[model samples]
Target: MATARKYNVEAVFKGAPKKSDFKIVEETLPAIKDGEFLAEAIWLSVDPYMRLFVNSSNVGNTMFGEQVAKVIESKNENFKVGDYVAGMFGWRTKTISNGDQVRKLDRSVYTDDKLSTGLGILGMPGATAYIAFLSICAPKEGETLVVTGAAGVVGSAVGQIAKIKGCRVVGFAGSDEKVQYLKSLGFDEAINYKTMTSLKETLEKTCPKGIDMFFDNVGGEFYDTIIPQMNTSGRVAVVGCISQYNLENPEKGPRLNPSILAKELTIKGFVIYNHLPRWPEAFKAIGEWIEKGQLKYNETVTEGFDNMFDAFSGLFTGKNTGKAVVKA
Candidate 1:
């Protein structure tokens, strides 16, 4: 029998997750059964959603995540040996899968054989940005757009895509490096939300025309600033409320109930899985943008699987400038 190493949750997260919440366990694998394939994880994604999911996830199950893996052996003809796959395979060294919730690697997006991107720009994050922004916000040329959490993979992609649409883009990040990184991605202005003495004053200066579209990734105090400043009929796409993810009790922030009606703003919240049928269209457009030099992406990769907890924890602290992943 073959054995695989896996990281399983030992405790349900109460507040912020700590290293003690997880455990590494070794397990034996049976021979490949019909319609199944064996894959070895090459890269694993450490994302903010897992933080929220952990609170309700099975305590003794493998940690929640996605990975890009190589199909080492296969009994399913659809999944050939040596083919690369992207799936929700969790934090494990190896996977035995029935081909459910898996996608074959798209060479156009993974150009030059960079499979790590399957978990970052070219995968879930990329699809989220492409479909959600274009569908919900419907960005127009010359509009002023504001993006919160602008340094993460989805937010960064949103900013760049807005730039491609000829929108004047402003971004907010937690650190000076991330602000500068957003600027490098052609954001018209990048503000450090943590260091800014007055977010209202900064917005007044940078967004003289008012925000025409808002791509919100972090909701909390930031939402208070953004909602009131939006132009009439502005569109707001709610992706993730990362700022409130780790809280044991979600904090109450400035009220936006009146502001939405006053500004006539259009706001909608979405999950990527809700738009799964559109992934092919999203991948085609994002890949074309990448090939045409219209899109750029970055990743803060941790070196080993043993350090996955560190990488996962970094998302809350703004330790990663873009997508945070573990090289397994």
Candidate 2:
């Protein structure tokens, strides 16, 4: 028998999530069945999507998330004991899984010290940046690409990949530190939106040729400002609306349909789960980029499982520079 400690949603979020919204519980696990494995979490991911998902989630359900865990005991032949795996096992210190949606971590790609990346640049965020940006934006050399929330796990990756594609990259982040981080990633222009006197004016000056492709993460005023400045036939990948995720009610924005129609913009919103089959393709490409020194990644890791809520809530406050993960 094993025991697991996990976080359960205690209340639905209002403006932003609070510690009182979750409660930690310990459960004694039953013995592993014929094809089950017991795993202890090594790293847990706290992402913006968790906040959005909580809106529709039932109270008392385990807080939704993904984690990298080690197989401590196994009855399944496919999953050996001591194997590391990444799975949607929630914010739990331990999990008993039958391997339905679990993937054994590729040792060749993730070494012992780098295993935490299984939740970051080499994992879901990497896949999202590679697959969604490439397929949706279809970036071309010499084109200008604008990324909002540009210092986040996915956004930072998107900027670098665009640079690798020879696109002129302009990125928007919240703080001066993040702007510098974006510049370090080789963004042609990094704007601190919080300090900009006029976002429209700064964007117009920075992207003189007009934005050719827009990878939007923060959707609100930034999205509104970028839409009217796009070149004709500009492509927009609506990856995330992080700005609106914490709102108790949806904030209305200026209607951009006129700008979209005038420019004949192509806009598509995507959820990464729909592209699951192509994840390996993304991982392979991103892994190679990392190996070649063409891509770099950072993680803002919180040290303890008890601090999961703090890490999760930090996404809205610009507290993380790259991927935000918790060591369990």
lDDT, model 1, position 154: 95
Candidate 1 residue pairs in clash (backbone atoms < 3 Å): none
User: What TM-score does candidate 2 reach?
Assistant: 0.99
TM-score of each: 0.97, 0.99
For every candidate in turn, the CA RMSD to the true structure comes to 1.2, 0.8
Please count the clashing residue pairs in each candidate, in the order shown: 0, 0
| Candidate 2 Cα outliers beyond 4 Å, as residue runs | none
Give the per-residue lDDT digits (tens) of candidate 2, residues 60-89. Answer: 888888999999999999999999999999
Instruction: Kindly list the per-residue Cα lDDT of model 1 for residues 77-111, writing each as its tens digit.
Output: 99999888999989999999999989989655565
Q: Pick the candidate with the highest TM-score.
A: 2
